[model samples]
Target chain A: MTVAAEKQPAVDRDVCIEVSNVTLRFGGVTSLADAGLSLRRGEVLAVIGPNGAGKTSLFNCLTGVYRPQEGNVLYRSRGGREVSLLDRKPHQICRLGVARTFQNIRLFAALTAFENVKIGAEIRQRTGPIGAMLGMPWVRRAERVSDEHAHDLLAFVGVQHRSNIIASALAYGEQRRLEIARALATDPEVLLLDEPAAGTNPAEKRDLESLINRINKELGVTVLLIEHDMRLVMSVAMNVVVLNFGRVIASGTPAEVQGDPAVVEAYLGTPADGGDGDAAPR
Target chain B: MTTLSAVARRARWWNHARVRRIGAYVFAGIVVALVTGPGGSEGHYSNGLRHGLLAPRVIPFIVGGLVVWAAVELGGRQLYRVRPLVTTVVSGSQRRWQSPVVRLVSYGLLLVVAIVYPMHISEFWRVVAANEIAIYVLLAIGLNVVIGFAGLLDLGYIAFFAIGAYATAYFTGRLPIHAPFTLNPFLVIPLAIGLALISGVILGFPTLRLRGDYLAIVTLGFGEIVYEFAKNQQGITTGSAGVFNIPHFSIHLLDINYDWGLPSLPYYYVSLGFIVVVMFLFSRLENSRVGRAWTAIREDEVAAAATGVATLKYKLMAFAIGASTSGLAGVLFASKVGSITPDAFTLQYSILVLVLVIFGGMGSIAGVALGAAVLTWLPELLRTHVNPQNRFIYFGMLIIIMMIFRPQGLLPSRRRAREIRFAEAGLEGADALGPTPGSGLTS
Candidate 1:
């Protein structure tokens, strides 16, 4: 058995999301091919790959933004009902408890921080049109509760002080944090973080790690992170999935994947003279 | 503990709510007494209110006006509550049943007052109030769809108004009919509407991709085009001479000949009915999935599409729906005026409608209605009591004042209110930019 499989024995059988034989073609280019990964509940799985490894495309397919010509993305809902993620709409996937943050923040800039978060909760809001229009008791109550919840979520991401600020006014780091909070407001079963630390400073990166850890441990939310920062991913993720040329080259513990010869070849393009630095940790 | 502070905070808001409720009751009581009590006398307030209710043309206006105010307030509150500038404290949990009930009761009261108003008012005052209100209501509703729901800034919507009026004239005027083209005046309404829809589609198709200021400019161009068309199309629209002595609409049967002659009170009722129907449909559409789609697109088109909302299709839908409403209003307007002229439709009318929607509350049915009534009546009231020569100045000043003091309008929807409040708060450092430094350059 693989080291990753051995380390996660209890959750090894608890695979809630499985991406198998997924191949994506963009005209003449192949974005992803035969890439397979399993995400279990209450686990943080990091997808680390080179620049052109099609990490974002994989995310898009998993979130139903794209349909791969040949692949099956099976997602097991909270109720243990298996469903195809590729068959659903993005909003439907969101409604089905799969929320994702974008690599480039996608916030409603004109809206206040509170409103930005509330929009994530809009799909789950129980009030009907008449209720919203008339400001009926039920709608009003729901809105108030949602507003408070949004505030709490913002606080969770350390942006509570900026609650009334317009989203566009926020700094880059704050905006990224706000996006995460907004995604969390949807109350997703699994949170997908796309390059959460891309433009963040070192201090902000540490905070992000703690935030993600807390969310996974305390909130009991599963996490699927796609990050380019190798050190951060190696430090936090329980299992690591590495991709090269849209295909999975290695899947195991961080240490095991780190030492793989294929991963070295994928990163350095087949090495220099006889693989002298093949096992180097750099 | 932290729980104690939370409870205390809740208690404070509860106290504020109590104070607000008491204040509302006191204010309502005082106003009611002032209007209905003996000391009020038969002066401006009494006359205005009575005239507003009694005139056949005015009754619809009164009902529509009140509805507009309520809608604006609701919309403004929602929109403003989210703004940083407005530290809004949400009070007692909203009671779902009370809102609809309150709206229904308010409308019913307005209708009742309208029906009984003429019994105690002067006929001339009544006629003036009624006529102004109905026309403005139609204009406001049409503009609301474009500016409010679609988030399109149209500086020349009045062109559609002109098109409908001219179409009516060409069909029903003394122009020579090549064949057996005699049709009922009521039928002309549908034809006018159809023509307006086609015009809207023609205009909207190319302009849908334009954003904000650019779109406004294009629409302004279209409005000018319509006006110019009416002025130059002498062979069809009688040019600047304009179509005159156009016959009032009538339905003739075997026994009853229902001729709605000149003063056009019956026509007011027809306009009222049409406004109500449109208002109902607008409200429904605003709350539907389509309405949500429009708002989503308005907020962020790229994000909306990422979420599976078809942006182009919905934007076009907004243009089509908004224009269609205006077309319906146009037909009513043409029928009521009983004439067609290029002078009737102008950029001024478009600006007036835009002002009404903005002053009332964008994307709010009731707010638009209120805006329509106020702007409509204000000019006429000025013409009668105030200086007629400086009426334009007064309106321009009013628009400026509304923008500065109550940008969300008298009865802004909650959402609009929140936006205005947010903008006012200078949340995004927008205020720091300080009064649009290059404003003159853009103008």
Candidate 2:
């Protein structure tokens, strides 16, 4: 159940999220079995797996969409407060500064791209419902701030030009970018993207990689993504966790995972004749 | 050969757009003439084709066709250019009236017209129509919150109206409970609203998880339960006999005191005031953060939840606010009529209000208000001309035709129009959170 064999990556920065031996089950199905991983404060970590390998389930557990029956998902805010994410609702977790994009793009389709991002920024405003209705001075100010922030995020993700167009009407790649912009609008300490480049072309995927890099390197926000594309995973992620059969089979630098016989076997179903791990017992 | 070719060319003229347009007018005129003409007169001569062409019946058809053709030529050409015309008029007015002063003046003029309307029209029935339509406008606006804003299809909205009416009766001592003191109908308004608000919560809390048709059925059942209680609650509701002698709205200020008369003017004014207030409030709610939350839930509940919106709280809030409007209308209805009956707040009333919201444009306040006024007054306007037995049939036909032509309703909100338009165009028919959001024709 432990993915600790490889030497741990250098922890020069704070750890944003710490998943401790989380296990989730639905009826008789074990969606995630004793899975654990830690996301560094400003590093891009990739969770790669084959189809039905429980990467999304693990994402759900982190986001509070699916509460793990056992173990803790902890969040460490920038202010240095460690909060248990276990009994929290999705929105509550979001408010604590964890924002995520869906595996399938879940942009508000009927809303304009600007509106979709504005809604994301809206949660950050503390104005009460009454204030919003009354258009109180502070609420008005907040709305202005929210609009500006949303526009900036859109610009950051390269979808500012499509601001007024409905999300559904956007090109597939543009919609993916808009989704990222919306997530960023939450002003999160950590951003979790579930397959951001799922349906995008190679050029768009490259843009996504650079976007993740910029979000991590420039903004210094932690980035954890679930990706299936090996090249995208290796290029963007500073650390990698490979899941096979609802468990983490490998955790290391991309090169170490590539050389790990367990990771190769999970992906290709057969070990190489000269695989280094062949010297070790299963 | 030349003569034959010329005849063929003449025959081809029927395929021309202009010729066909005129032909359509001629055909409509002939049908009207046939329908309105007196039944077959005795002593008609033989030779069917020649006699039919020469008969006196032909004159009306020919004249009708000429008149229709003239009208089309004069006006229908502009109708064909309606899209451009509307855009020009709207944009042109926008440019001309850019100042707040000009906009304010126009709004003032509209307000003056609205206030002075009943004064100029002395017809008793017309006043009654105005009063009734105003009441329905309030109801439609309330139901719009639940069905249009929150996307909760509530079919039992009239139950809140009934609750309001009964609360008015009970508070005013019209009910058999016969309190030691009777309150003014105006005084009971707040109590009635509170009662309706409570009732909304009671119904909503248990059924918030249910959606669409299931929620609709549960609300419908709630309405039926309320109706049944009002009908057979024995002495409390006075059973089917209902409460009589319900007090009218009265004001007893320091110097002046007046009791409302049975005439419809006072009631119409009050209802109009309520309608205006409700419209203002609902419109404000529609644009605010709470409104955004409601729309988010409507668009996708799971996504809304994920974004930190408490779906249950907002859903219940929608019910409370929506029900409170109906409660206000109920108090107005009980006071205006001076009587209360379970039969008055039947399932039909619920459906009628729903029809108004849907017909007008669910999320559009102006649309729903217009829908309420038009649907309520149309029958009265047509009563003299339309056959009594066929009036309902015609009404149903009109609704069906309207829905067929404009599924988004008469005055759809931009979002609703886009959703329907996209669906029709095969662009994005399925919703983003729909069961098959990822499984679509789009790659």
Candidate 3:
């Protein structure tokens, strides 16, 4: 399997994560079947599908939230290190520079906004439990850095005013932004955002489009998004991958996938019409 | 017409929710008094009721009603409306007491009082303070790390305590199976802690994955297993006879030599010292990075893991810390008593210690310590009034009432207070992480 994939010459070291022939099934139901995609370095790739095309499941497979029974997820870090994410726990994958946010907002609701971000930032720091307990000078220094970074990220996401407020008390848009800030705090080289603009207003959606661009361009991080907003995807994503019934039916530039007959038919009524993908945002 | 209107207005007062709650409290107080009250002269409630019309009973009821009403009303956020002067004085004193210099002076005075307290107390009281109150305080503080900090329920914690005591006995050559070399009780502290830590890791590695009630039931079974093993294993644990003649702790360093003998005062001092040390360490750990990690895990495990917090490792760490503390307390117990028995390490002690943690305030250091002291000593104080075996009946009543009235415990941590207060106000409750698999209303 490795020789065949290597012989193709497409699985290069620059691919941040490669999902090939990865299949996930729940009992008798198949959430994903032989689905595959590659996230290249420092690129914005959007995964689009109807309600049950297994977009989130593919994200889960990449982020180590779920294991694929059929194939493996290969993660290659920025410094030329290779790791198979199949056997790793969520935290271990996170430590390996893979960070993600949930489709449903999953911040620590009881913690302060600053605390939520700081918890994320501190995960990558090298401090053992004993060091934390002893409050060694280096640990304090590392903690101070994390605190400052949390403050910075909060401001970066434009929610610094809600620093001390508990996360549950924040507004809907603010919570979404705070979750982004938290995901960014992991210092991730690759970020997986699951439906970040799901319930936001038009103005908040505009803010989210720019935020994704900044996260991809300013931070030099590879972005893999599962978004339903076709306007945001066409405007921000470099390429789009469309899934239908747990299969990647279309993969190309935004304009190309937008005109694919399979994409239009899978989204609209039938394969006979040439309806633009922008009309199927729901 | 004016008199009739006034009568109607007066009748409407009981409809208020707060008033109805106070009425419920009064009824509960009355029921407790009636059921737990002393037997009548003829061993019948009617016999006692026929004469006085409950004169003293009526008086006690009125007093109790007034107290509950005051507690309910004053416990509200708007205390100034009732008495501005009282509220001002309370807030002013709290602010003053929390200032750095004032807190330092208060702590110094407190330490002095603690030191001077047992020295002058009666021998019987001193023994009770050390044997019953102080020991349980140590155990409660240990369990606080598990239940309070980690939000994991452990009903089999006493198993670790038993392990510690057995390690102490084995090290001192008191058990039927002797050690390779007899060691002083002081020397056995570290070994016992290591043993308890390893035991906790063994138990928690597989079972910690089970959340809330399931984890609690597993810990409960672990405790029963240890208890049965101690009871039935004659060759190893001396088979219900228990290990006897465990030596007292002593230190012989350089020219200075001190021995913990049969006097209970030294034991109280030592226990107090350990309690102080553990409190300091745990409090320091509360706001640190590790502490935040624990809070994150407790709040939402899946989110915590996604954010790179190792949930399993930190959870296992909490179990180990809690178990090691229980072990240390066990070593102290064996040394202080100079005898060990399976009777001392029962499921009842685990429940009683949990009660202390909840009664005091789950995560607050001073609160749990105060809870342990009060609950344990109160029963002893009532030794002449009530049979010792019936003490749990009162505790059950106290816990049930407390759960209804003040589920956050007596003095909650600031974060917990905020969460519970928000939850009570119908905010930050079911809607936040309501359907998440890692977080639920486990309690």
- Which segments of candidate 3 are over 4 A away from where they belong? A1-13, A271-282, B1-80, B83-102, B387-389, B422-443
lDDT of 3 by residue, B1-443 (tens): 99999778768978666777776777766665565555344345474344333546645765686687777686665554668888889889888977989977877887798889888889999989888888899999899888877778899999999999999999999888979998999999999999999999999999887776788889999999999999889999997898888898898999979999899998899889988888878877877887888777777778888999988899999999999999999999998888888988789989889989988887777778888888888887766665555566666777798879988788777566666776777753222112235354111
True contacts kept of each: 0.10, 0.38, 0.73
Give the candidates in order of TM-score, highest first.
Answer: 3, 2, 1
The candidate that wins on lDDT is 3
Task: Return the candidate ranking by lDDT, descending.
Answer: 3, 2, 1
Ranking by DockQ: 3, 2, 1
Better of 2 and 3 by lDDT: 3
TM-score of 1: 0.60
Per-model C-alpha RMSD: 14.6, 6.4, 5.0
**Model 1 chain B weakest 10-residue run by lDDT:** B433-442
Q: Judge the docking of candidate 1 as incorrect, acceptable, medium or high.
A: incorrect
Tens digits of lDDT, candidate 2, B1-443: 99999778877967666677787887776656544443332343234334445568777787889787876776787777787989999889868776869966875786577678878776666465545887898999999988878878888999999999998888888788876767898988998899999999999999977776778889999999999999998789998987888888999999889988777877888887887777777777787777877777777666666666677888999999999889999999999888887898799999999999989987878788888888888777666664454456557867997889987787787776776776777764233113223322111
Candidate 1 residues A113-218, lDDT tens each?
7767766655566555445545467766876787788888998999999998878778999999988887888888899999999999999999989999988998
> Which pairs of residues collide in candidate 3?
none
lDDT of 1 at A186: 81
Candidate No. with top DockQ = 3
Error of 3 at B360 (Å): 1.7
